[model samples]
Target: MTEILEPENCFCQLASGSKGNALYVKGGETAVLFDCGLSGRELERRMAERDLDPTTLSAVVVSHEHTDHVGGAGVICRRFGIPLYITEATRTGSTKKLGKTKAMDIQAMECGKRFSVGSLEIHPFSISHDAADTSGFRVTASSGAVLGIATDLGIAGHLVKEHLSGCHALVLESNHDPELLYANPNYPWPLKQRVRSRVGHLSNEEAATLLDAIDRSRLSHLVLAHLSEENNTPDLALAAAYGVLNGSNTSITVAKQNLPTPVLSF
Candidate 1:
């Protein structure tokens, strides 16, 4: 189903964080969930909240094997009979994690290769995350609108920056504030190290640096996602972003942990 008469970036972060994560991005004739991190029921409710119908989805693309990214993939695929796209390594790693599903089409994809799902052209790139294999996506809609989604990643290296550059919109990871993370008494030293590792989430500074490095001159929309509830606050995250993007026209929205952000059109 076409969302608009003209080609535009139709996007939303259904949910974002450790508890769960999901995102919706639509093209004129094709719609997809970048990650279905919630249960089937919860996913349905959120979609309903956004006025999105599951029947319209062409596929549920899996970025990695992490529960926060792949939890609802199986159930949604089974219930709706939507196609599933994932790398072979990611599919294998998610076996036990993503429950069971009916006999559905499982498409294999690899980093550096580009594929299309109806109206969206997608390019998957390697991302540094502690998964069997994690992918960051750069998607272009039929309208020629480009969107870059890179979350659940540790470091934003040269490859990631190259892939994400010159997008009309981006959903990036601004996972935590380093000071809060280090000082949080509830987290053990080992857990902190893991979170601070090159394979872990991005801190506010790291996220800002990546933003500054990327070619955001053409970027109109920015959604900061996968924030840590225990160690990060919206104010802190926004502060870092605002500092770098000062005097810029790019709209910034920090994704929420409990609710979905309003539908964003670019």
Candidate 2:
């Protein structure tokens, strides 16, 4: 049987939020999924809405073992017969969450190592997050287009800034607003503390500060993702990032929890 390939140098945010997070990236004939947080059914539906065919996916690469990042991984791999890539620690920690499922190919990846999926080269780097062995990726296509992704991390440090330096597009986290998160009465004290910790998610201000440290000379598109539904609004996140990127030619968009962003191509 022959398989049709997806378009070259394209990226899309299937879903992004505290609710779930998934991203689709295709370079040449190879298509890879960054995370599968949505249920299998929901993920499939959203991909279809974007005219993407799951069967064409080359692999499902995981950033961490958190439920919001790995919940739908098992089902998606089982259904599409695609390989699942993650660090050994993440695989071990997520065993219970991933559950038992039909046999599928699993590949262990190491942080700071570069790997290839068809014509796309992926470099995974360690990130600071609560999950075991969380990673941020820099994917460069055969066409020389680079897409850098750094979500679920509390801070974007020197390593992250270095990897994301020359990206053409970026999907960065703007998880919350400190003021809104602190004022939200629904969240308990410990939860708030965790969110504000060094290993927790990045607030809007933190994300903007990280952007300030990075080189955006070649950056054309920036998508703010993994927003907190309770403490962050699209307008707020957009404003923070827009403030930092005011002089650049980069196009900005805030990813939605319930919808997929438009397919961005380079």
Model 2 lDDT tens row, 67-112: 8899999888888888889899999988876766448688989999
Candidate 1 residue spans exceeding 4 A from truth: 1-8
In model 2, the runs with Cα more than 4 Å from the true position are 1-7
Maximum-lDDT candidate = 2
Evaluate all candidate structures by whole-model CA lDDT and list the values in order.
0.90, 0.90
| Each prediction's RMSD to truth | 2.3, 2.8
Error of 1 at 33 (Å): 0.4
Q: For model 2, what is the error of residue 98's alpha carbon versus the real structure, in angstroms, after optimal superposition?
A: 2.2
**What 10-residue stretch in candidate 1 is worst by lDDT?**
1-10
Whole-model alpha-carbon lDDT for candidate 2:
0.90
